[model samples]
Every structure is written in C-alpha cells, then in structure tokens.
Target: SMFVTNSSFCTESKECLEYLLVCKTDEYEVRHYSPTRWVSTDAEAYFMGVGAAMAFRRLFQYINGANEGGFQMEMTAPVLVKIPEETRMWEPAVYSLGFPLPAAYQEKPPAPTSNKLYFSEMPEMDVYVRSYGGWMLSVTSRLHAHLLTEELGRVGASYNHSYHYGVGYDSPLKLLNRHNEVWYVSEGEGSFTSQRLV
Candidate 1:
C-alpha cells in the first residue's frame, strides 16, 4: 500500500491555526490536528503553533517512511493567506481560533474522546492554495480570509455559502523542535495538487 501527506501554514497572526493531514492507501487511514491550539496568545504563540504542527507531520512521515507496500502516496503542504474585508469577492466561510497546549502545561497527551480533533467529513469541492515561510507579525485570521477572497476574485472563483474550517498541525514538544511546519485546510477540492517536501 501507499500513503500521502501534506502541510500548510498561515502567514498572518489571525490565521494562527496550522494543520497536517495524512492518508494511507492500504489501511485507508487519515489523521489531522493542530498542535499549538492550546497556548494563549503572547509573543510567539502563532509561530510556536505553526512550528509544532510542522514538526509532528514530519515525525509522522519519518516513522512511516520505511514501510514497504504496493500502494503509493503523495503529500501536499499549503499555507492559507488572510483575505481583506474590502474585497467583495468570495463569500466568507466558517472561522475559528485556538491556542496550542504546551508540553509543560500538560503531563501527557490528551485522550481522544471525540472525532472533532481527528477528522470531519467535508463536502467535495475544488480550491486554490498558497504557502509561506518565515515569521509573520501583526497578522490576523481576517487577513487570511481577505487574501483568499482576493485570490478567488482574481481567478473569477466565487466563494460558496458554507463553513470553512482551519487545521493547525503541531508537536507536543517545544517550539525549538526542527522540521516543524503548520498547514491549514481552507477549502475542499474537486482535484488535488501534490508535492514532495525537501
């Protein structure tokens, strides 16, 4: 069997949530989460969360890299940008915000009690995606929402009337961890764009 993975990040502070989603072909497994959604806003909350999510996703791939299977998989990492309010383009979808729980704050990983933290079914659709690197300050989710709105307008794609969710990926370890990258899912897809991480 084969597997695929992807990561994304938000360049603005308001788009703090980062996410990582992975799929396995053989077992048909899919998993995702926001690692830094528990820490309160401070100086480095946004970057920390993004870093954690990225790290976790890389760790996940590293652990599964040696598997031998007949199936094949691909991965994608997308960073959602904030859309401006002045843009009268795509319609806004469901929006949310949260902080990550630091390891020092929790003695152990929280037990899974609900599907909300794992995976939620999304309506099938197509979407445009962009990614970013480095740290962004004075950023907000509104910025990301606005960015998407403008992008849609540029391409003549109007936003659908529905709730869009943000996914943030992170690790339980500290932000110093390397290979930490955050990814967010802004919209569904009628098609997919896959790329490998170097």
Candidate 2:
C-alpha cells in the first residue's frame, strides 16, 4: 500500500511521528514535502530543481555504496506528481516515489500558482535514470540531454520519456541575486554522471 501526507515544515516534527506509525504497517511507503523550507520565493523555482537533483544523487550513492544485506537500489528520472496541496512528510521509507515538480505547474509558466495533488494509475513500464547537479540553463541542459541520448543509443538503453525537475534547497526570501540560486536534474537517463556537474 502507498501512503501520502501533506503538512507544513513548522509542524513537521509533530506529523512525522504519526507517519512513522503508518509506515510501519504499510506495504509500500512514500512521503511528500510541501510548504517546504526551500520554497521561500517564486524566483528560486528554477534553481531549486538543480539542488534537489544533487541531493538525491548523493543520497543514492551513499545508500548503494553501503549495500547492506538484501538491499538493492534502483535509479529513476524525476516525474512531476499531481498531489493534493494538503500533503506533508519528508522522507521516503521503503519504495519512495515522487515527481520533482508540482503537477499543476508542469506545463504552466514560471508564475505564482497552486493546484491540488492528484494520484494516477501506475504505468506498466520501467526506465533507467541518472541525476545531475549545478545550473541547467537552455544551453547546458540540452547539451547534457543530447550527450545522454547518444550514449544511451550506443549501449542500447534509451529513455521513453525525459523530464527536467528542479528542487530549491534554500529559502528564496534571502536571495535577490541569481547566483544564490541552485538547480538539480531530479531524474533522467544517459551516460551522465554527477561528476560532470561538479
């Protein structure tokens, strides 16, 4: 079974304990974070994606490296999940899954808006993914995508779908400059490496 929660960061401490109880009994676990500490302002949206991707990469590497008994790690490209605005909770217990961006904003422009989170039926396919860090402007992101496509072709591994999900780690209120912003590629597949971004 999959579970979802929506809560504010300030109230997270209280809600987390409740989530832990549910997770203990649930067959599949997934958590969502919203009203996030990182989303302080609208301008930071673009860079936030990059930061999230990098964090995820590091987390994945650390978990996989330990490779404890019967533990297996699978990589995924980020997809935006449309969830209700009332969800909260910060960690993935077992079989954690989420889309990088809010679903309502997926095709919308970079503007102020909000939408309800909607869950959909699961797809019947699998994809490989790699994460990237640093800024992903038009020139850089596209270049990376192309390189990935080429490499995947050579290895007979290709993506059925590709998306660029950004996560903002810092609060946007403190920054008035672009340099203060960071972006991460939450999910995608190719020969791309986290080192390339560093």
Best by TM-score: 1
How many backbone overlaps does candidate 2 show?
A: 25
Prediction 1 TM-score vs. true: 0.31
Q: Global lDDT of each model? A: 0.29, 0.27
What's the TM-score of each model vs. the native? 0.31, 0.27
Q: What are the per-residue Cα lDDT tens digits for candidate 2 across 1-198?
A: 121233332121111211221121111112222221011111112333443444344334322432224233332222221111121245321111132223322232132122211222222222232234444343454454455555556665444433422222222232332221111122232221212100
The digit string of per-residue lDDT tens for model 1 on 27-145 reads: 11223433221211111123423533443443233223412232112222222222122323253222223233222322332322322222112223333333222232224333443
Question: Which candidate comes out best when scored by lDDT?
Answer: 1
Instruction: Evaluate model 2: give its TM-score.
Output: 0.27
- For residue 80, model 2's alpha carbon misses the true position, in angstroms, by 4.2
For model 2, what is the error of residue 45's alpha carbon versus the real structure, in angstroms, after optimal superposition?
15
